[model samples]
Structures are given as structure tokens and as C-alpha cells.
Target: MKKLILTVLLSLSGVVAATAQPMCCYNPVLNCIATRTSVRQYAPTAIPDSVTTTLLQAAMCAPSAVNKQPWEFITVTNPEVRNAIKQAIPNSHAAKAPLCIVVCGDMNQALEGQARDFWVQDCSAATQNILLAAHSMGLGGVWCGVYPNTDRCEALCKVLKIPANVIPLNVVCLGYPDPNAPAPTPKDKFKPAKIHVNAW
Candidate 1:
């Protein structure tokens, strides 16, 4: 009877320990999600290659329509090239960040109308992944839109020499934070009438 009681207590303690440790550091993930903000200012310090690769890996993990994975990333670390990109993008503060990742969607793999206009959705998901991963890594980043604007797209196309079918979706700037940014408070974006109980 004593041996069985001890075994039961040890098993219970093991279960408790497993649950207490959390599946994957939820607090840090929550901290990343809660404290993440669009960091416009960045320190000139360079980020190590390992960190950059980790962030890209996280971005690539984002889901895509039909598993088409119609996404491409162009990382620009050269100051001269980054400066040129900044000039091409009017009012884009991406140059401040030490690194910039250009997110694009492959038109050839798009389902209909480039995934029936679903390319943006897929690209946006990737961008969000970049942002979240940057935050989680204790780095700051921001997503700056570029594709929809013809002038901006044309300028980038001329500079990068990208093919016509590849669409530039956004430019993600990443670096060590230079400011104490605030998190966005959740707003009531949905109205009560918009809610449907069981039927529309």
C-alpha cells in the first residue's frame, strides 16, 4: 500500500511539472505579442546572420492558399542598396533599420487572378510572421506596404530588376529598438449588430 501511494504521488507530481513548464514559454510569446509595435527608429548596430535567418524561417512558416507557397524574400543588408530602396519608396523609413526583407508573391503560382487576388493575403501572412518573429527574438520590426502603388512598384522593379510577374508586397525593416514604443490597445472594431447568433 505504501509503495502504490508513493508511485501515485510521483506520477501526479510529474504531470504537474509538465503542465507547469508550459508548452513553449507562453509568457514570452504573450510578451512579444502584447509589446510588439511598429518600430520606426532603429539603432545602427548590425544584427548577426543567425538572428536574421531565424526571423526569415519564422516568416516562411506562415500558411498559404493551397500550399502554393507563392512567396519570395529578398534580404537587403548593404547600406547603399538599402538607401536606394529608401529613395525609391517615398516616405519609407526602412533605411533606418539595419536590415530590410522584401516580401513578394509569385504571380505564376497564384491560383486565380494571382490566387483570385489572394496573393495579398498570403503575402500579408508572411509579413505578419516576420513581425511576430522579430518581436519574439527581442528585435523590433515594421511592415511597410509597397506593391499596390504603381510608382513605388515601378521604382523597385527598376532598381531590383525583378520580373514583371513577381509582385513586391511589403518591405520589412528590422533592427534593435531605439525607443520605448507602446502597444496598441484592442479596440472594439466589431459592432453588436454585426454579430449573428445562429443565423444571419
Candidate 2:
């Protein structure tokens, strides 16, 4: 009789323990892994300011070299600036989204031999944070490369009046998703001939 009573108590205790704790925030890390997709076509509706704030906060949390945090974000939401950004990215389809984030890296903080230009990696991490945060917030977005193309960079510089120290890294087009687009599947993990184990 005592054994059965103890088992019931243990079971009840387990249930109470499980129900006692409140649910936590949506797992940002898991959201980052599962729910990310490049969303080019956005719905006409504008994203809420609170959602945008969460995304920017995520970007700010990204790791930086020596804590320099050499990244700057320029948001273009005005219709005119959005139109100008659409024109700037020759490869992108018409950016009809309500907002775009220009991720820029400061060249002045690129220390010698320390992670081979932290600007690129640091900015990339920030961009990834923005992407993940957007996904978590139920917003659609896509990252468009911009820096390498000198013509595009120059054009944006002139348009946005960016200083010389700040170099454009990428542009993120963000807004509500237009429709149910299929998520991209993971690429094959098979290694190629170039991938050598131990030694080349």
C-alpha cells in the first residue's frame, strides 16, 4: 500500500512541476534554425514598429571583434528612399517592402591579422541576427549583397550620403510575406574533391 501511495505522489509531483513553470519566450535559437527563408516578395502591409525594434535588438546582440561593434544600420522606409534602394540593387526585383536595412561596416576598425577583416564577419553576424529576428517575429525578409560592386556602392553612397569610413555590406528587404512561398531545402552535405581530411 505504501509503495502505491508513494508512486502516486511522485506522479502528481511530476505533473505539478511540469505545470508550475511558465512557458518561456519562443526559442530564438530554434527559430533561427528552423524558420528562416529568403523572402523576396513581400506583402504590401507594413511591419509593426515593435517587431522592427526586436530585430534591431537581435542585430545589436551579434558578436563583434574586440567588442568594437563596427556595424551601422540604415533603415529606409520612406517611399522615395525605398524606390531609390530598389533601383540601386540591379539584381533584385522591385523592392515593394515597407522597409529596408542597409548593413554597413566601418573600415577604420579592421585591425591587422585579427580575423581577416572583422568588418565582413561582424557585419555578416549582425545581418544573420536581423534575418533570424525577422523570422521569429513572423516577418519576411531577404539579404541582398551590395558591397563588392563598386558602382552600386558609389551610387548608394551618393544617395544616402554615407561617409568614407563606412562601407556598405548588404541590404535586407523586410516586410510581411506576400504569400505562402516554399522554404528552401538544405543543400547536400557531401564533400567535394577539394575537401581534404587531415592534410591537403
Candidate 3:
């Protein structure tokens, strides 16, 4: 009985205690994670410098492999440059956003040997952190891929003059949500069937 009570107390404190039943809590961080969604349409209003700084700080807080911290960022506000990048990837939301943060993986800072590609994972985690930070601040963002598509990465590097040691992983398009744009409901992504306990 004491153990069950302790479990209930932990759940209320936003800690995930082992249980098959649905747990309840009011953690703001968890709420931010759960509610965050891609905002493809953005208003023309510019994001303030202070806000941009905060977003970047949040990105840098992401976990990295062996503390490699291999991420680098390029901020774009110029319309001509934005348009040039748009021509490279037609589906990118950056052209419409007031701020486009190009997240890159710095190979120079990456792990060696079989873990060489861990920079990609590190930068991806950073990108997600940026998006969540934006959402928590009432702004919105979308992730647009760049690497693996060699042609797109090359075009982006040419426009931005990216270093040879850095590879553009993705561009995070950010701005205030367009008031006229329809609000999207957060998707129900939790699937009990997908959860494999103990082993596969």
C-alpha cells in the first residue's frame, strides 16, 4: 500500500513511475514537448535578437556524443540569400520565415572511427531543442533537410560559404505563427502497440 502511494506521489511530481496505467502530471516541459508541432506558415513579423539568442541557447543545451558538441549554426535574414536557398530546396519553409537557422554538423568536432557519423545525431537533437524552445516561446518552426542530398548541401554551402569541415544537416525555419493560418491540432502519436517492454 505504501509503495502504491509512493508511486502515485511520484506521478504527481512529474516523475514516470513504473505502471501500465496512464500517468498524470502537470509538468510544463512535458506539456511543451507534447504540444509542439510544425508551423509551416509564419507571419512576416521579425523575431527579436534576444529571442533568437534564447533559441540558440536552448539548441546548445542538447545532449551530444562524448561531449563532441559538433553543431554549428548559420542565421539568415536576407531575402536574396533566403531565395537562393529556396531555389535549392523548393519544399523548405525557410524562404517564408523571417529567421532561418541552418544547423550544421562540424566534422572537425565529431567523434572518430565507427562513431564518425554521430555528429548527425547530435545536431538533430539540437535542432529539436530549438524547435521546442521556439514553441514554448509562442513562436513556431519547421525542420527542412539538407545533408544526404549532396546537391542541395553544395548549393547551400555555396550561398552561405560554409566551411569544408561543416556539413549542413538541416535548416530550421522559424517565425511567429501567421494569425490568418489555420491552427493545427497536435497529432495523437502515442501507440501502445508500438511499445515493446523488456525485449522485442
Candidate 4:
């Protein structure tokens, strides 16, 4: 009887250790997600085409509604074009970054009729993947909103000469962060009060 009790305790301890191991380990994915912060100021250094391609690949890997994959990405490196975009959307500081990715949702690629509304959610997930991938690659980025605001959306379309079927969702400014920039504080947003057991 004592031998069986000892065996059970050993197994329980093993389970506890297994559960605690992840909290103490160096998890790169979790680190990337935790350290990702919106960096507005950037260095003059330009991001290479290879890195940009990798980021876009990461974006495209995001899940879509019914696999429609209605997202489109446009990388802008031209100062003139960036300046024009900044002028159109005055709140955006995208001109400062060496690279600006305009994330769009192609309405023509969406499902027919009312079901097409899922494109916005699909594009949002893609945008988040781009930001996370940029952070993982040691680059900083900022997401500047564009869609849901008719005026801002129209301004971007006019300046970039975007096709009517494609709508700009947001601009993700990407670059090497300025060395003098301050570090971001960790945001512990987990709230026990917000959680419900089984049902709300």
C-alpha cells in the first residue's frame, strides 16, 4: 500500500513540474508576442527586400474565412509616395519609417453577398501576423488605421491610386527602431474578474 501511494505522489509531482516548466523556459514565440510594442520613431536604415518578403509570407499564412484569403499587401518605399500618403492621412507618421506596408482587403475576392463582411476580420488577423513577424525579426512597426473611416480610406485610395475593389485597411510602418527609443513596459492585462466558468 505504501509503495502505491509513493508512486501516485511521484506521478503528481511530475505533472506539476511539467506544468511549471513552460513558465520558466525561454519561449521565443511568447517573448516575441510580449515584446511587440508600437514604435513610432525609426532609424533611417532601410529594411531589405528579403525581410519584407518574409513578413508578407507570415501575413499570408493567417487563416481566412472559407479560405477566401481576401488580403492584399503593397510595400511602399518611395519617399514621394509615402509623403503623399502622409498628406492624405494627416494623422499617420508612416513617412518616417523606411518601409510602409499598406494592408488591404480585396472586396472582389470576398464571398458573394452579405457573407463578404468576414474579409475585414480576415485582413485584421493578417495584419497582426505581419506586426508579430516584424518584431520577431528585430524590426519595429506601427499600425495606422485606415478602414471604417470613409474619409481616411478615400484619401489613401486617391493618393495611392488604389483600385476601386480594394480597400486599404491599415498602414504598417516598419523599420529599425531608433537606438535612443525607450523600452516598453510589460502589460499584464489578465483579469480574473473577466473570466467566467462554463457560462457567463
Instruction: Report lDDT (CA) for all predictions.
Output: 0.82, 0.80, 0.90, 0.90
* Colliding residue pairs in candidate 4: none
Residue clash pairs of candidate 3: none
In model 4, which range of ten residues has the least summed lDDT?
19-28
Model 3 over residues 74-190: C-alpha lDDT tens digits? 999998888888987788987889999999999999999999999999999999999999999999899999999999999899989998999999999999999999987788688
Between 2 and 4, whose TM-score is larger?
4
Candidate 3 residue-wise lDDT at 91: 89
Query: Which is superior by TM-score, 1 or 4?
Result: 4
- Candidate 4 lDDT, tens digit per residue, 17-82? 887653215688877776688888888999999999999999999999999999999999999999
Off by over 4 Å in 1: 1-27, 179-200
Instruction: Give candidate 1's total backbone clashes.
Output: 3
Model 3 residue 149 CA deviation (Å) reads 1.3
Model 4 RMSD in angstroms:
3.6
How are the candidates ranked when ordered by lDDT, highest leading?
3, 4, 1, 2
Candidate 2, which segments miss by more than 4 Å at Cα? 1-28, 112-116, 180-200
